[model samples]
Target: MKNFKIVFTFVLFLLFSFSNAQKIGVVDTEYILNKLPQYKEAEARLNAQIDTWQSELQNLQAEYEKKRSAFENERVLLVGDQLKLREKEVMDLDKNIKTTTSLRFGANGEITKLRSNLVEPFQDEIYSAIRAVVDKNGLGIVLDKNKDNVISHLPRYDYTDKVLDILLKGSDKKEKTNSKGKK
Candidate 1:
């Protein structure tokens, strides 16, 4: 009976201590991004750019294949410096294709740069909106519910709509301000 009382008292004490603590909130960044029109447009533009680059890479590879086949067939027929020059041409074309591919789509390449340029602005806006919500609500912590380790959370604790609201509201305010300033 005494042990039960002690455990019960400890539970009550913990509850009381936590009652005054700052609240925790969760935001789904993907959900918030989806709510932003600019994000959708940026994603579409990035995907289109990626497709164009991929097609170009494919064309380069095809050209390299043709050159390689031609060189293999004529290699035995040619002799001396003529054979060497043709082989060198094929090798240089292959090297140029690899260099182009690396420059366009490799790690830390043009694709990454384009994605950053397109998406970073929306990311910044989302972060600022989340920060504003946290500061205004006196939240102690804000977790991204999109993260893998977050298995479950209460719906009431989810602040995804609040973040979207803030972002949309900010944009609306900007539009209104711009219109008024024009007149």
Candidate 2:
């Protein structure tokens, strides 16, 4: 189904491309992001967070294993109430670890939220820059070459560098404003 969507989008892009002599532009958002220093910093921060989460998860798993091992070792000698309590403690710890792992790493989890928080502003800026580029170029259709939407694209039609330039210009303007205020 996903492949079908990709193929369909590709077909539409080609169709639109050949339909008229109107200029069609291609923007690679990934390339644009890669050029931004801010994106690199955000990526580094995200990687650090992922590393921390992985270490924390490993510690949790280790703690769970210890509790489970002790419970198993003492189960034979434990009386009714004591055995039940030990069993419950082990079970609860296992459950807690699972929940914590999922909360940190699963879909729509904290890591995902953090990633979005870090990347969304960059994406928005890219989008706006792409729009400005399209408007300036009088583009009829814009296809993303990065997502396999285009099997091949001519260098002439690629507006990624132009869009990146616009994005950088906007970033420069912001920096100048911020510096002026700071001083």
Candidate 3:
């Protein structure tokens, strides 16, 4: 009985030491990005540009629809050569509308480039902020709350709110200093 108790105590001590030696942290990247002023500004700017493009596209569509309705209404009264010429004009307008629609709304190389241009810089900033937090906190491992599949059972204190606060404050200070320098 004495020997068995000694073995059990040693096993318990080993398990406790191993568990206590590990340090883990979690960060909600999505939350941080959403709350960050810089990200919000970038998103707003991109959305405004998209809105402008959409407005222009709407105008073009409206003009094209008006011309189409007029042509359809006048189709019965047209004669031979006049009818052919009018039909040709309608065809040309239809082609112009198709081209413009493709240019404005198509999922193509240009649109991809625009998305990358808008998103890449913001992504870089998020990554930099995360790195800053990790370095400052001396976190052994930082898991992304958004991507951690097994994190549903973890406690809230495992999250690195302190690191996030530091990162946000540091970024704000840097932005203010840069703005002052520019002025």
lDDT at position 32, candidate 3: 71
TM-scores for candidates 1 onward, in order = 0.84, 0.85, 0.68
List of clashing residue pairs for candidate 2: none
Task: Write model 3 residue lDDT over 66-153, tens digit each, in one string.
Answer: 8778878998998899888878877887787778667756777345567678678756766676677667656677777788554464
How many residue pairs clash in each candidate at the backbone level? 0, 0, 0
For model 2, where is the 10-residue window of minimal lDDT? 17-26
Candidate 2 lDDT over residue span 115-143, tens digit each: 99999999888889888988898997899
* Better-scoring candidate (TM-score), 2 or 3: 2
* Model 3 stretches astray by more than 4 angstroms: 1-24, 109-112, 136-141, 147-160, 179-183
| CA lDDT of every candidate | 0.90, 0.91, 0.73
Encode model 1's per-residue lDDT on 133-160: one tens digit a residue: 8998889999998887578899988889
Task: Tell how far residue 155 is off in model 1, in angstroms.
Answer: 0.5
List the candidate 1 regions with Cα displacement exceeding 4 Å: 1-16, 177-183
Candidate 3: worst-modelled 10 consecutive residues by lDDT: 149-158
